[model samples]
Target: MPKDAMAQKRGGWIACPDCDTLHQCGPVKAPHDVKCANCGRTLFTRTENPLDRPLAFALAGLVLFIPANLYPIVTFSFHGVKTDNVLVTGVYRLAEGGFPGVGLLVLLASVLFPALYLMGMTYVLLCSRLRQYPGDFALTLRMTQGLNRWGMIDVYLLACLISFIKLGQLATVLPGPGLYCLGGVLVCTLLASLGFDPDLLWRRFGARSDKAGSWNLLKPKAS
Candidate 1:
């Protein structure tokens, strides 16, 4: 029997990440969400356009990423003295001001992990689009999973905006290109996260391979 037929016959199972309970499901169509039978937690949503949506947004986010981090987030001028701040300015300032721990948190949450997550997501999705899973694909996917929760770019962006408002009162504060770029990347990443469908990946990369079609199985059913 073909692996595809075998998969269809068994109707693959997905384990609830929250409760370790298993649920059997078939090839569900888009515009529907699969919820865990035990925990009622949403396992994943079937997007109308699966890899394409995340791929496009992740690419857009990547395009803006360099400028977002490299350029000045904002500029402040007081009495003919002007200074420009980039995304990492807060981290540096915090460390210099006796808040090393806070600075590290800012670095990890707002900058490092988020950048890695976006890059990994883009690469993983791109590989999926090309139907070529590299040796590091699984590793990259796992990295994205751990890094997703730490992306606090929006929080840091909000902080920058507040600083802009307050510094405007004290001096001439101007929004910089980096600020706009950061905002764009944030929106793109948010949309990418929303549209990402992990099940597609499971089907392509996690299933047992043969001459037959694929199975979208993330975890094996309990014995």
Candidate 2:
């Protein structure tokens, strides 16, 4: 039987993340990237060292996160007086201005959530690299996904730029060390998420096809 036909018989199929087209999932030769059949988008590439890339990203994110919250993101100068704003100061300013709701939102999405997200991702990657189970691996993976969406460092950066433009006429706005660190944080976290493959973790844990959920939709059938 043809590979695709046999895959269908064995319920080993995978849906493309981009186009949702079903394809028989099977092991490809090492060092080749997999592409979606319908849209031809790259699905996952085989890396010479899978754990190294993701682990490096996660560590970099964690390192940058500290400076992101510590240094002043921007400084405003008016009439020769200057004021610096760090991550917490921004949140406090929002609250003091009577936008308590917005303050809380900024606190969670920008400050606390991003920290947790980075830490969680770092922990997961470390555990996977060590080949050691860290509590419930699947549950940690799901939680990390939720945190990933909530971390809005990029959105915060956009807001800072808008504020700089609008406030520039009234005061001189200068990007600070914190602003650059935040940018680094965003880049590192994004790269970490992109490099890590959840399917590899599932397979490592010995999950059966039935337990693979949506991932099994692409499994190639055995010959």
Candidate 3:
């Protein structure tokens, strides 16, 4: 018969932060706070809540993503000549304005990155919920981390706001509702990514699947 998968063990001896004493803890089956057995120092406790929190955020992101992609992210008026551009449209405008390089950069930063981040996050959340053990959990974790860096929708929004503020009289600029919705989605996705604990995936699935450990082992140990 195949060996039993390594499930997360709940009860264990945790090192006391204050006294350096090892304290026996009961099963941490839920999110709560516990005290060290010897020093009574408070310690964080968490259960296998799965990916419910992240899933909720991902769903919210999906909802907001519609507007972010559908409506204009920025609107500009120069001498009463109004022009509105969404994320992709901005890239096209930049290219047409003889800034092909900048257009490519913006396309990668604002369009591709945000979409990839959302899709990756959604995949991870759904997979975790289904209890489907990914062959490379570490790869998924790294993808999520990469997504965090690439999600620049919020930054783009800020840039638009700053530009609008500075060009108030010369050329009026206004943000569209899509911009606000995209901003919301960006924030929610970030929060969801941060709150997601990759360790939880290993716990629910199995240890052999944790590639993070391999990565950790490759790193030089601290003195």
Evaluated against the true structure, the overall lDDT of model 1 is: 0.81
TM-scores for all candidates: the values are: 0.81, 0.76, 0.68
Residues 1-223, model 3: lDDT tens digits: 0121234343344457698986555444545556776778765445344467777786788788888888987788998799887778878888999999999998888877776776776777677667675776557656775777776877887888787888787887888888888888878877676556554554455443333224235666899
User: How much lDDT does each candidate structure score?
Assistant: 0.81, 0.76, 0.69
- Candidate 1: regions farther than 4 A off: 1-11, 207-223
The candidate, 2 or 3, that scores higher on lDDT is 2
Query: Where does candidate 2 stray beyond 4 Å?
Result: 1-22, 29-48, 208-223
What's the residue-level lDDT of 52 in candidate 1? 83
Provide the clashing-pair count of each candidate structure.
Answer: 0, 6, 0
lDDT value for candidate 3? 0.69
lDDT of 1 by residue, 88-187 (tens): 8888999999999999998888788878888998999898778789899988887887777889889888888898888888999999899999999999
Q: Pick the candidate with the highest lDDT.
A: 1
| Candidate 1 lDDT score at position 75 | 91
| CA lDDT, candidate 3, residue 218 | 65
Clashes of 3: 0
Please give the distance, in angstroms, between residue 208's alpha carbon in candidate 1 and its true position after superposition. 8.8
Cα deviation in Å at residue 75, candidate 3?
1.9
